[model samples]
Target: MSTHLLSRHSHRPRASLSLLTRGAAITPAITLERGRAHEACGPARRSFALWLAASTQGPVLWITPQWQPVTLNPDGMMDFADPARFLFVAAPRREDQLWAIEEALRSGAAPLVVADLEEPPAMTPVRRLHLAAEQGGSLGVAPLALLLTPGSGGAAGIESRWHMSPAHQGRQRIWQLDRLRARTQPPACWRLQQKAPRSGLQLCPAPQADLPSEGPHLRATQQ
Candidate 1:
């Protein structure tokens, strides 16, 4: 067989997954590269992870500390992703939780693996996850591992870092999404809104500060 024909017949996995599609000419869709580890922080990090899972087709492996009292509410997940599609792995220790995440990515058994950690992990483990994901790609599908950290996540050596927080109004479903850091993109913020339950997500640039260019310069006189 010719080299060209052989290449054409080969299976090619998607390089990235899109979370939010482009809105008009504002910006291109939000995407996370496959076979890499990314970070999501802030108050709505879990929701952010769900958005990513919604865009992919496969079982989702969610790892959280078994001791943590908080649990995912299926009723609340309906709007984002089907709860049935998730497989929960509760690790009793922090180290165990990360270990599970690394193994899951290396196996390529699930396209998405989420690790809910109380604190950000150091660069060492993050690098391991990245390598694991890369190895998994060769096995079959390239898994995307998401690290959910509290507050402003500071996970090192990640492909990207995203922060999301609720910014809702009376009845409007709104959230502020910020791309804090990325390997190839600059920092940017956006207002994400879901007009209706099934309407889908919409994005708009975050509103600029309303303050004047120069705050009234106060003149002080000797008293």
Candidate 2:
């Protein structure tokens, strides 16, 4: 019975291996998936975006609300990326911020675009972004889009969602990358170690052995 079932299942098609991030063969491709998006939040969002920026080519378009309580310092960002490659747009209102993100994705001039938000945008705006990214917008590859929110992100209708928190130990600046939501993969976690003096992003698979007998507490991941 098992052999027969296996034979029947072997006919199904499989997705190709295409990765945009540093590691993980199981992570989904960040290309041409309409009506889906990626999200990350918490204190590690800036460093995560900056780490992503280094892996891609072309300019990065950054959008934020003018009234946003926090600011992006070019001097600090230059430590991970070239500040000159970033085009900052301050949207005076929430609607304008969504519009800016939509237009930037539709233009495809940037290889990556990061939007810093006080809270998650509505589902409609998220759908528009997914559509624009899938259409390719006259570029060879669809531009990657990331939304940064405060607290654990709860972006509606996204392809994948992640939560990052600082877990520094001694002189090392370490971070925990939690894969909150994904369509095809199970929840995962990683330890990101930032090597000093420009060694770049270093990723390590966070061991699952430390999880409790009941399993890892998931409350912190999907928030």
- Highest-scoring model, TM-score: 1
| Model 2 / residue 175 / CA error / Å | 0.7
91 in model 2: Cα distance from truth in Å?
0.2
Candidate 2 lDDT for residue 107: 75
Q: Report how far residue 124 has shifted in candidate 2, in Å.
A: 1.4
Total colliding residue pairs, candidate 1: 0
lDDT for each residue of candidate 2 in 97-185, tens digit (9 for 90 to 100)? 88888888887788788898889977888888888776644446667788998788888887777777767655555677777877666
Candidate 1: list runs displaced more than 4 Å. Answer: 1-14, 21-28, 205-223
Which runs in model 2 stand beyond 4 Å of their true positions?
A: 1-36, 204-223
- Tell me the TM-score of each prediction against the true structure: 0.83, 0.75
Clashes of each: 0, 1
Whole-model Cα lDDT per candidate?
0.81, 0.67
Q: Please give the distance, in angstroms, between residue 34's alpha carbon in candidate 2 and its true position after superposition.
A: 10
